[model samples]
Target: MLLSLPNWIIHLSSALEWGIAAALLFHYGKITGRRDIRLFGLAMLPHWSGSFFVLGYHISGDTIPILLDMSELINLFGSTALLLATLNLLKSTKKTSATSYTAALAAIMIAGKPQSYLGADIFDAILQLSSVVYITFLVLLLKVWRRDRTIFSGLTVAGFWFVLIFISVTIFCMYLATVVRGYPTLSHDDLLHGLAESLLSISNLMIAIGAHRKIREYKREQLNAIQG
Candidate 1:
């Protein structure tokens, strides 16, 4: 269903998705005014804006090295933001430290800038692998704490799994591109990419919904405390 879409439509859908997600995150952050939430929302901003780069490449049909470079840079920043957000989440649990996150960041930082298809694929693979560990741990935490009874606990666990799937799919795509010709298509129309995008957007929305419920509960508690 996704691969057949026209170029304009694909990127348009991407814009709609990441745009809505960013807005939700940002609004929630403003309401809570928590530093972690604020940073998480801020991290979402670039992923939304970065869709334009995908659109630019599609509409223009020009694979400029600079354009790809810029998009990759934006992607790196988003990854960093993701790492930070995960670290923030871990603060409450204290199950892990920032050591792995730091190592991932360092790996990305020390790596050479991706200038070719293979280079880009390798760089992205590393990023995905780095995130997979933290995300997996989060999933396990949710499973273990399943009895906590938070409204969001289920959704958050499922969302993290979905995110893991998307990242794994992305890594697989990189592998296929390495071995397959006409990979990702010169036109960039791809079923795997489309599926990954859809899954990611859905996962974000699901997590956002769960987070909103948590906020509502927090507000209710605060109001009740004030009354009591």
Candidate 2:
């Protein structure tokens, strides 16, 4: 594997953290009796699965470009799933047609992207489309927060959006690695690669911690109610 032991640990931790976050969110839904939230947690699975494809690509020493492409494609679907799940939550609060809104936003987001054979350009387009979907999901999340903060803590919502920071930093680090340091890829530079990936771990940790706190608070509230 091209990744060092520490780098593998970072990657593994990120995937595990995301899984924990999803599980916590699902548990939160179970306790609160919110099917939409549960669906949201389930929607996170595709992204988690995509992460494994990433690990597989790394394990192949980045030789299997197809694995990376599959990861991107799966991530695009994951982003769409997340967006739809959030829209379902919003539907409970507003009478708006979630399907219609999702369709329109998806159309707009996908219209300009150049479709081509499965290669760098195609993968990049998929990444861009996924980013748009995720951003839309974040916007809807904020709206959901406005309607109901009890479903998720503010920190949890913030953590979801904080992924943008990880993306931005990773891009910058890739530039530094390839362009500045003359490394062929970010993975070629262990220190900078680990630094960039660690941001993902931090963001995932925030998400898990926030969900756990909310779960604890919800249980306490339930206890007080029962006692009273």
Q: Given candidate 2, what's the lDDT at residue 166? A: 97
- Global fold similarity of model 1 (TM-score): 0.61
Local accuracy of candidate 2 as per-residue lDDT tens digits, 99-121:
77777786765674535323457
* Number of the top-ranking candidate, with TM-score as the measure: 2
Position 181, candidate 1: lDDT: 43
lDDT of each: 0.58, 0.90
Regions of model 1 farther than 4 Å from truth? 1-10, 92-157, 170-196, 219-228
Error of 2 at 22 (Å): 0.6
Q: Report the poorest 10 consecutive residues by lDDT, candidate 2.
A: 111-120
